[model samples]
Target: MAQSMSSPPPALAARGSQGIILKETSGSRLESTISGSECRVMEFSSDGCQLAWCDGKSVTVMDVPSGAVKYTISKPKTRCIQFSPLGSYLALWEPYAVTKDVPAGTPNLHVYNSSGELVTEYIQKKQQGWCPQWTEDEQVCARNVTNEVHCFSGGAPGLTCDNKLQIAGLTTYALSRGKLPYKIVVYVPGSKGAPCFVRMFAYPNLNASAIMASRSFYKSDTVSFSWNKKGSAVLVTTTTEVDKTGASYYGEQGLHYVSARGESNMVQLSKKGPIYDVDWNPNSEEFCVVYGFMPAKATIFNCKCDPVYDFGTGHRNMAKYNPHGNILCLAGFGNLRGNIDLWDRESLKPIKKLEASDSTQFEWCPDGVHFVTATTAPRLRVGNGYKVWHFCGTLVQCEDTPPKQELWEVKWRPFPAGTFPTPSTSSTAPPTTIEQPVQQEKKAAYRPPALRGKPYTYKLHEEEPPQRVGAAEEKEKDKLSKSAQKNKKKRESKLKSKEQEQVVITRGSKRGAEKDDALALAAQILRGNKDKVVDPVGSGKSDSEKKLKNLRKKLTQIEQLKQQQAEGKQLETNQIEKIKTEQSILEEIEKLTLS
Candidate 1:
């Protein structure tokens, strides 16, 4: 085993013969391929020095650099595997089972060390929240037990539970990473009229008196937690079994932020629909959330929960920040059309737009400049494959499974922080070595022959147009002061009065009312009221009829204003202006009838 193994390459696992292929991250070259019964589960050590996989017969751990089998444990039924941050320990989980000989069932979760020695085990019945958590130093290990959390101190080899945090209805717990004096956050679902709560506690203390932050809310049956990279705070996504409003079939969800320093806030989303995703920036000072109904909106908010930038509404339901936190990938998949949009967080400009149809998994490379998207099996039994992409939207590598074979999963090997520096933002995308088949454009839906060229006033939904990234901030900058606004209105009023007075002076001209009406029409155009004077069809007799109809509508509005004025109501500026146009409206009606 050599120190060079500290940066392992990515691994791919597919069914049938292709057990596991370790591919170099620098290019589309195969580093090594380990074939077995079937590579069902594969994981890389946090340091990337070792690679482990289970093929139904046994679990194998290999030193990445030497290509030597460092440890082999016979765990035939293992379903998942994970390695500690420092690669000091490995954890394996098997499907929970019961037998006549052992009715209660055996401990299905096993923890082992680098020497292939069993260190600990637990009976994790449910597979949902199965993996154990470890601090960055691997000094503290935490696992969820029945209505409690068991904490193991003194890292691997001689790990032992030295403390326990007890909480009734404890369903899930998350361990924060980074330096020691680690923190733990726990979730408790509500029952018996109590509200669901998520609370944080500093490590070792593990008591009520040491609780740092807590949040309580209603309508939550389960929750998922996401801690920022620095481990300063955590975002809890609360979800219910059903949405009471019946607005979404996916259920109702809310996002809440809880920091380590006793500060908490329920993140307020602008839209009123299901929350699709929330990802914290690597800097940990800001986060991005994708929420609302179909054609969802994505917004970035600061620590105070104030929106910093809105990505606007789109057919996207997921937002992911790259390893460097400089790039963001907002994508729409599953039920919506598959469109992937890459954006530069610093510039707030879109980097690239591409599509990976039927993609179910996405992962960023340790280098932060490249990513991988895959369409795996079970989620989609057909078209199981994966593609490697540059952040600038280039398809660097594409691997489609053979017709008989099905790809299950593809993973980028985990590397220690600072192992690979973030590529410069100005760098261009690498030349595409793999070509993706160009898909045909979807045709517009069929319309009846009679309505092919006819104008229609129907729309399926109000599709919001694309907006500039800083449009809101730009508008804020363009806002006028109160005094300036008042002066502007005064100037507009004087100009309108001057034009009206000029029309009155011309009322005595040779054309009389006809010339006066033409001036009034010109005034309407200057005031942005051309729609009121112009016939949309630009036709013959119908144009005159439309003008007469508009004039009668204006007279009716004038009568309503007079009634309001008689009732001692103060007319608004625009309302008073409309009243003054009444005489012009009557003159226009007479001219239209004569014409």
Candidate 2:
């Protein structure tokens, strides 16, 4: 079927034995007809404005809606016609060899511009080979019997077929449809008949350096190979045949995964049934495979080759991933009824199913959300065309071709539109810098001598030291020197007095009498009677006993002063001086008593 953009209502052209029927896509009404017989192939331009068809030896290019022939090329033995992706050119080729009487090296392939002018012709080295194919990027390619692919650069006036590369034992090949441009995957039989391998080759050059070969397997005859939308992996289905004695078995089947770099996990389908079809999801990393015959099953597998979903118990005929790759369409003939099941790839569940007595082929729209199912008429009857439907099972429209005509094929015209969202660009913010205050070394704060033994406490606000002027600095230095000298003197005098008091206490007996004598000296110093104080002894007189009592009272007062100093309390300078004087007097009294 050919869909034309030039047609205001989105026209679809279906070929039948009578001719070609042009109908509106939104309705079943016919718009125009191009009368022809045995139309073998039809294709629409990239823009969907022009339609082209080949009837064996002749090809016709037409304005789809007007049903008027733009140009007719009478090329004998023309097998197929294809429009370039850019809609600027068409490729026509003959798959079979030329007749013996034809000129010695006649060209079997011809290239024509949109204006129907001959652009180039490809002369074959051999009499027969595959037809020429156009790559997604518009390069013309053909493979010869020698397993060598020849690429021709499409340009004005002609195509250059000078570039050629050999792929030994090439069985089949598929071009990647993903971001990796022009990556060609070719299957080649293994050396020594061990197994077959799938290898990827770079386009154009087809260099040995870029070739990645997959693992070898016994089933070298590949049924089909499909590439994921991301071009990360390829799904391959192969069949193996075994001969025992005089009997031949052909049931060994397998499904394998090959990475873009040609790595294989060597996973095989569990069932012994032959794999009929395999399709990769365009939007995800999963694929669906159809196998078995009696009660066929469609199984979906992730990239890891793990089964994720199963459509149980049906005679599966065909399964395909929608262009968006989010939906899987499964169709098969069962119980005399054709079943078309639409499945959501993400959910792994069925979204819709339509049953028709003769439905067979399922073709998805380029929009991805819609698809069409082609059904044949029952025994040369009418009503044999295609049913247009949304993924949700809603019938959009249906058009039946002329009666008693077989619908050869149905396909949506390829358009330059995307069903998936474009990747968003990352908007990263620039790094930021923070300013910090300049750090300065701080001097240890000054602490009073009385509080030096305790833990240092931090001050919320410390007063800055006064800055000294030129003359005032000298005066300040002198004052500090004098104060330091005075403090040293006081410290020395206090140490000496403590030593003398310790000596007096050591000389006396370890008794209350020594304590009393020191107390008496301290009291005399405190009362300003430094010379009257005397050391008490066992004189056996009442006056001596009274002196002892006075010494005890003064000793208690001296102990209280020491306690105050230990508590971090400051003692008056006079009191400190008085204590030092008492210590001196006590030492002298001890000597006099001893003598």
Candidate 3:
């Protein structure tokens, strides 16, 4: 049961029944046409210029300058297909029912990416009626349902704990959206009536395996998270949820100052009303936010320690911190006068205010380059046809030329500033050198091809060098060479010393021989022609001479002594034998008897 209608979509009804309002931009007008599906809202894009509308049957793509219809997309009728923020891809939010039998049950959510070519379908239940957002970096997609926001990481696969969020929020169901190019994610653990107060995780895909994470928490629900280029200052909106009787519980939605380093310095934006969102000035000095619903208001906090711009009160009023944070754009929404207001960063006074025909979602380019507004359909005077709406945001032709696009801040940088630098004269200056400065050496991110760095091991207990076979050769060589020259010299000195001893001994022998001969002559003189038997005077030489003579005459003397001793003994024996013969003859008779 689908109903087709010839009724043109309501000028303001961009989202059918759902009331989806597309944010404004400054680019060329989007292609628009009536579609066949009965009463549906959708936006279409071709070659980038988006033509969006609500409750329309079909969308037509056309050439920009010539207005030529390029292509048309027809389908089972989807909610919307939007050009991704970067313009390289398209994001389609397709909602289909589980079955006609049940209406309140979970519905299947499908996403068609990269120009309707690839689609990934996922079912998100438990917390129903959710609208998800694609993060600017395409790293994650988020959905907002009831009081909590569900975000799914794009790189993750399978059902993991981190893959889902049951973010508890007890505040008013209003969510103010803000994004910083470098910012990731924040988590606040809410307990009961208190606005979610827990750790806010802030890393890009924590290794998918959940090995590590960079997270911090705030004890509140904030609508806006603004970033300073240095990541030092982020403006956070504080909200205080109040009950029906106006009894305030959850959150003191105060403006907070946080260093990108994750230091929380809270600044209460308003003590009573819920400060929807907070944004920092491009210069990082101040921040402003929109609050007070019936009478939308804006307020600014100047310096970290001070209050600068305080635009105390107004309704349907909005404040935008530009991409660069240099300028703050203020626009008022609601009755009386349809006007857009701008404010200077230094002067709190209004510099310029343009009567905006319609809608209030706009911003300065990321470069602080241009002003983009939502341009409503052209003014018409035929038959109460004032119902024309501004499509997607309009591209405000910049009054003051913006910074070059080349200087645009990209979301991520592959190489560090230390590794590469943009062409700047200051960069060429030689870096200062410090003596004995402690430097942390960086390890190689990737392992070397050849090295595995296995466990330390001993090479099978090598034999001691002292007992090795090769040691023998070295030992022999060492022995031969050990102090060779010095030892040879010592040997020569020792041989000389021994020669001196031998010389002394030989000389002593010669002297003894001479003394012995002299002693013999002395004996001859001492005897002197003895007729009266003077005998050889001391036939033995003087004691000293005898000692010398015997020492010299050793072997010959010994032989002569033995011969003399034998001759004397033989003579005595002959005498005894003769005497014994006489006795024996007489004794012969006696001997015979004794026998």
RMSD, one per candidate, in order: 13.8, 31.4, 36.8
Q: Would you estimate the TM-scores of all the predictions?
A: 0.76, 0.60, 0.43
For residue 98, give model 1's deviation from the true position in Å: 2.6
In model 1, the Cα lDDT at residue 428 comes to 76
For candidate 3, lDDT tens digit of each residue in 1-595?
A: 2111211221121322222322222222232333232434444432224443323444333333354555454444455555544433444344555667776545344444434444544554432233345445545555544344444566222233233433344222211122442333344545655444322333343222431222333444444455554444555554544444353454445555555454555564443455555565645666666665434556665555344445645443566754444446666533323455555454444544455443333434322323444322222111111112111122222111112201101011011112221111111112222222133444844545564585434443232211112445567667776688578879999999999999999998778766656644443343242232222234354554444333324323333445666778443565445444533432442333233
Residue-wise lDDT of candidate 2 within 143-242, one digit each (tens)? Answer: 4435866666552324446566676677566666554356667777767656677677666658767676555667454446667766677776766555
Two-way TM-score contest, 1 vs 2, winner: 1
TM-score of 1: 0.76
**TM-score for model 2?**
0.60
CA lDDT scores, all candidates in order: 0.80, 0.63, 0.41
In candidate 3, how many clashes are counted?
42
| Displacement of the residue 347 alpha carbon in candidate 1, Å | 0.9
Candidate 2 global lDDT: 0.63
Worst 10 residues of 1 by lDDT: 1-10
